[model samples]
Target: MPRIVLHDYFRSSASYRVRIALNLKGLAYDQHPVSLVAGEQQSPEYKALNPQGFVPMVEIDGERVTQSLAIFDRLDALVEEPPFVPSDPPGRAHVLALALTVACDIHPLNNLRVLRYLKTELGQPQEAVDAWYRHWVVEGLAALEALAAPQAGTFLYGDQLSMADICLVPQLYNGRRFDVPMDAYPTLLRAEAATLALAPVEAAHPDRQETAQ
Candidate 1:
C-alpha cells in the first residue's frame, strides 16, 4: 500500500469522521494538519488539493480524494477486512441512511464556514449562533435516537461497528463541543461509550492541543 496522508484539521467534524474510519481499519497514515482557524485551508496549495477548501481531503496511493464520506467508502473498498458497511443489502442501506442524516442534514448547518458567516456576514450574536448550532444537532439527534433504538447494539448498527458508527461518533463529539444536551439519546450515548472504548478510537481522539489551534 502507498503512503496515506490525511490533510485535515483536528477540530473539523468531517476530518474527525475520517480519522475514526482510518483508525477503525487499523491503517497507518500521516497527518498533514490544515488549520481552518488560521485560514490555512483557503491557501492555494490546499485549495489545489481540494477545490472546496475543506479539511479531511485524503491522499491515498497519490490520489487526492475529497469529502469525508467518499474517503471512508474508498478506504473500505481498499481494505476489505473489518468492513465498514454491512454486507446485507438492506442493512447497508439503513446504515447509509443514518450516516447521511448527520452528514447531509445536520453537519452542513454547523460547519466552521457557515458559523463564521452567521457571525460575520449575518452579524448574529454568539449566543444566537450557538442556539442555531444546538437546535439542528438536537433535531438530528432526536431522529437518530429513534432510528438507532431498535437496531442499535454495542454500536449504531447492532453488535458490529459499521460506517454509521464512524459517522455518528464524530457528530456526537461535535454536539458535545457545542454543549448540546445529549441526555435524550440514551441509545446514542451507550453506543458512543462503546465505540470510544475501542483502542483505536481512543488513540485517534482529537488532541486538545491540536484542537485549540
Candidate 2:
C-alpha cells in the first residue's frame, strides 16, 4: 500500500474528523503538523499543495484530497468493514444529516479563520470571541440533541458507529474548550462517551496526536 500522509493542526476540528476516520479504517499514516497559530498553513509551499491552505489535507493513493467530509467519504469507500458511513440510502441520509449538523452548520462559524477574523479584524475582545463560539455551539448542539435523542443508541444512529459519531466527538471537544454548557445535550454526551471508549476513536483524539515542541 502507498504511504498515507496527513497534514493537520492538532486543534482543528476538521483535521480531527479525518483522524477519527483513518483510525476507524485501521490505516497507518504519517501526520505532519501544521501550526495554524504560527500561520504554517498560509506558507506558499503548503498553499501550493492545498490551494485553500486548509489543514487535514491528505495524500492517499498518490492523490491529495482536501475537506474533511470528502476525506471521510473516501476513507469509508477505501475500507469496507468497520464502516464509518452507512450503506442503505435511508441510513446514509440520517447519518449524513447528523454529521452535517456538525461538519457544515456548526464547524465553519467557529473555525480558526473565522475566530481570528472576529478577534483581529473585527476587533472583538477574547471574551467576546469566546462568547461567539459558545453561542453557535449551543445553538447547533441543541438542535442536534433533539435529532439524535430519539434514535440514538450507543452511537448516534444505533449501536454501530457511523459518520455522525465521527463528526461529533471532535466538536464536543471544542465545546468543552470554549466552556459551552454540555448538560443540555445528554444524548450527545452519551454517544460521545461510547464512541470515545472505542480504541480507534481514542487513538484519534487531538491530545494523543499533539506534536512535541
Candidate 3:
C-alpha cells in the first residue's frame, strides 16, 4: 500500500466526508492541515496541487486528487469492502441525489468563502450572514427530509450504509454548528444518529481530527 496524504481542514465538511470514507475502508493516511481561515489554501504551492483551493486534497503516493465525491468513488474502487456507493442504478441515483442536496445545494451556500463575502465584501453583519446560512440550510434540508423520510431505515436508503449516509452525517454536524432548526427533519436526524454510531464515522468527526482547534 502506498502512503496517503490528506490535505484537509478539521472542520471542513468536504474533508469530513473523505475522512469517513477512508476510515470506513480501513485505510490509514497522514493528515496535513490546511487552515482555511488562515488562507493557507490560497498559497501558490497548494493551488498547484489543487486549483480548487480547498481542503480535502488527497495525495495518494504523491499523486493528487481533489473533490470529495470523486475521492469517495475512487476509494470505493480501490478498497473493495462495503461499497461507499450503492451497487444498483436507481439506488445509486437516489443516494447521489441526497448527497448532492448537501454538496451542491446546501454546502456551497454556507461555506467560509461565501459567508466571508457576505460579511466582508457585502458589509453584512454576522447576524445577517447567519440568517442567510439558515435560509439555505432550511430550504435544502426540507427537501432532503422529504426524500429521506420515506426511505430511511437504519440509514438513508434502508439498512445498508451508502453514499447518502456518508454525505449526510457531516451536513448534520454543520447544521448543529449553525443552530439550524432541525426538528422538522426527523428522518434525517434518525439516520444521522445511526450513522454516527458507527466506529469509523465517530472517528472521522471534526473534533477528533489532529488539526481540530
C-alpha lDDT score of every prediction, in listed order: 0.87, 0.89, 0.89
Which 10 residues in a row give candidate 1 its minimum summed lDDT? 204-213
Q: Rank the candidates by TM-score, best first.
A: 3, 2, 1
Better of 1 and 2 by lDDT: 2
lDDT of 2 at 57: 91
Model 1: lDDT of residue 114: 94
Off by over 4 Å in 1: 208-213
Residue-level lDDT of model 3, residues 32-102, one tens digit each, is 89999899999998998889898898888888889999888888878888897678888889888989898
- For model 2, residues 1-213, the per-residue Cα lDDT tens digits are 568999998888988888888888888899989999899999999998999999989999669999988898888778776887678988889999999999888999998899999999999999999999999999999999998888889899988898899899999999998888899898899999999998988888888876734
Q: What CA RMSD would candidate 1 show?
A: 1.3
TM-score winner between 1 and 2, please give it.
2
How far in Å is the alpha carbon of 128 misplaced in model 3? 0.5
The TM-score obtained by model 2 is 0.96
Query: TM-score of predicted model 1?
Result: 0.96
